[model samples]
Target: MQVYLVGGAVRDTLLHHPVVERDYVVVGATVKDMLDRGFRQVGKDFPVFLHPKTGEEYALARTERKAGQGYTGFVCEAGADVTLEEDLQRRDLTINAMAQDADGTIIDPYKGQQDLEARLLRHVSDAFVEDPLRVLRVARFAARYHQYGFDIAPQTLSLMRSISESGELAALSPERVWKETSRALMEPHPQVFFTVLRRAHAMQDWFAELEALWGVPNPARWHPEIDTGVHTMMVLEQSARLNATLPVRYAALVHDLGKGLTPPQHWPSHRGHEKSGLKAIKAFSDRLKVPNECRDLALLVGEFHTHVHKALQLKPATVLKVLNRCDAWRKPQRFEELLLACTADARGRTGFEQTPYPQAAFFRRALSAAAAVDVQQIIADGHQGKAIRDKLEQARIAAIAALNDAD
Candidate 1:
């Protein structure tokens, strides 16, 4: 069977980008033929096989037809008869539709190379609108390659807007949406992902909490950006610059959901947004089936970010209370992530992009001081049960007090 390298490997190579994985499309291979050739069948929905020697994925050249709705509503057709051009036509983007033969000859029936050279992210065909997931995928691609000056083709963007307005986005599973969103969050310019979704009118369907923030006002004294949505995007961008983890980035993303609930009459002043954000964060986490790590960090940042910002003025007991509420001593890594999220939030406002965050250092030092309290010494002094607990708290409080005094 004739085999050709396909999809991401080909596309990334053309852009002089690193190829993470190599996928092959067997142009003339049947499922039975692959099975007889020692390739193990792996895909449940389609004829995908693992190469016996290389162990890389080798999917038979296939074409799909719209069968219903959402991403899964498709009938895939694959066989020895499917042509490379036909298989390429089914891809979501023109840049990803190109393939390469064994002799390294580039196949460009859809002119993917031309689009690549033009720095345009154009869809392969009218069939692009058939899958709702393509909207997120395109947005994600924009986020990933925006640094390279890539922009979506106007026609493709119009199609994305159409897909968003067609009510099909509602059929997409939460898991699928989060999958794209989480990946997008880790990109260099994650803000573009949300911006593209908003442009397509798709944010309300999946990210209503975030969409609600677009017009919401915050105090210009603190947030010159004023728009809560703009602040959120800036926080996300700062989190990326800090090389934060997924949980930290996700926390920064949802940290200001409470601002969206502020009464318009209170204009520019959201007094209790920190705690008010918990409900919205929980709803988002539950709806998306977000992992516990991500949800926990998001909740901490949502409910206590203001406390971190006001740390210098808070009493030692109050600071200790904040630490205990976040379980900082027990889960030190998560606590650090919370601090990063808070730092991102502080730096996200207008004219604050490069501002130093001394609050983060203060919190870290306070945590270290409190965490260093000698619990074993209290136990050794015959303190037990309630007495030992009381002594430990007193020692931790003393340590935090010492830290504050030193500062």
Candidate 2:
């Protein structure tokens, strides 16, 4: 049996990137052959085994035939006769289809190395369109390599657009969609993920709220970009630059959905957009079955981002209200994430990218001062039951008021 390192390990090595994991494609190997060698079988649809020593995966060289719909609708063919080239042909992208043998000799039946050098994302074969998941995968690769100036090839982009229009993306499960989207959000250039999907007209299939924002107008004074979608992209990019977490990046992406619901007459002024956005956020989050952490942050940013932007002007009571609404005392980290998301949004506008946002520090200080109120002292002073709760509120309000005065 011949074993060759394949997929991401080979591709990352060629790009001078650190390889995090290694997988192998074994040609001329049978299930019995692998089992006899003490490789533990793990794959349900096809032959895949964990190495007896290194614990890395070794999948038998195989080919697939499209048998039904979506990504999982495929019949696998693996045997001792299957060639490494045949297995490579079934992959999604040329950049990921190359392999390396045990002797470190690179195998390039599909010219994946050439495409990688050109900073291009090209499909491996016509079989690329068989799996709808490839569309998301290609978009994710675009996000991953965007800093290296990588772009999807025109022909491959055409295929992505065709796939988007074929009703196949809709067949994907919500969990699978969220898995791709959340991973994309964590990428260094998360905005590229949505940009690629938008270019292919695929956003409407899964993110209709975001898609609707593309042509929608925003106040040019506040958002120099004018387009809500452009503003959202800038926000996502800024969030990444700030090293924000997945939930923060996601909040930055969806915080402006309310602006899309503005009436035509309202034009640049979305007077009650903060409240309006809650419905859109809920619907979008529910559709994707987004985690509570992400959904809650998105909801908080949507409802109170404006309040955060006006931090310097809000009364001490108003500042306390915002803190309470964010549940800052209970989940301080989440509250910090919300502030980062808002900062990203504020700076996302053109001409505002590098501007300092003291509002973030102001609110953070407000939360700190309010949380520092001496609740134990209030209880020790004979405050009890409803009186204790009232005294706590009074003490926190006084503390926040002192903070405002000090500022």
* Residue runs of model 2 more than 4 Å from their true location after superposition: none
**Candidate 2: 10-residue stretch with minimal lDDT:** 398-407
Q: Candidate 1 clash total? A: 0
Quantify all predictions' global Cα lDDT against the true fold: 0.93, 0.93
> Residues 1-407, candidate 2, lDDT per residue (tens digit)?
99999999999999988788999999999999999999999999999999999899999999999999998899999999999899999999998999998789999999999999999999999888899988899999999989889999999999999999999999998999999999999999999999999888788778999888887888887888999999999999999999999999999999999998998888888899999999999999999999999999999999999999999999888888898888899999999999999999999999999999999999988898899888899989998999998888888888888977786
Candidate 2: give the clashing pairs.
Answer: none
lDDT of 1 at 25: 93
Clashing pairs in 1: none
Score candidate 2 by lDDT: 0.93
**What's the distance in Å from true for residue 244, model 2?**
1.1
lDDT of 2 at 311: 92
What digit string (tens of lDDT, one per residue) describes model 1 on residues 91-197? Answer: 99989988899999999899999999999999999999999999999999999989989999999999999999998998999899989999999999999999999
TM-score: model 1 vs. ground truth: 0.98
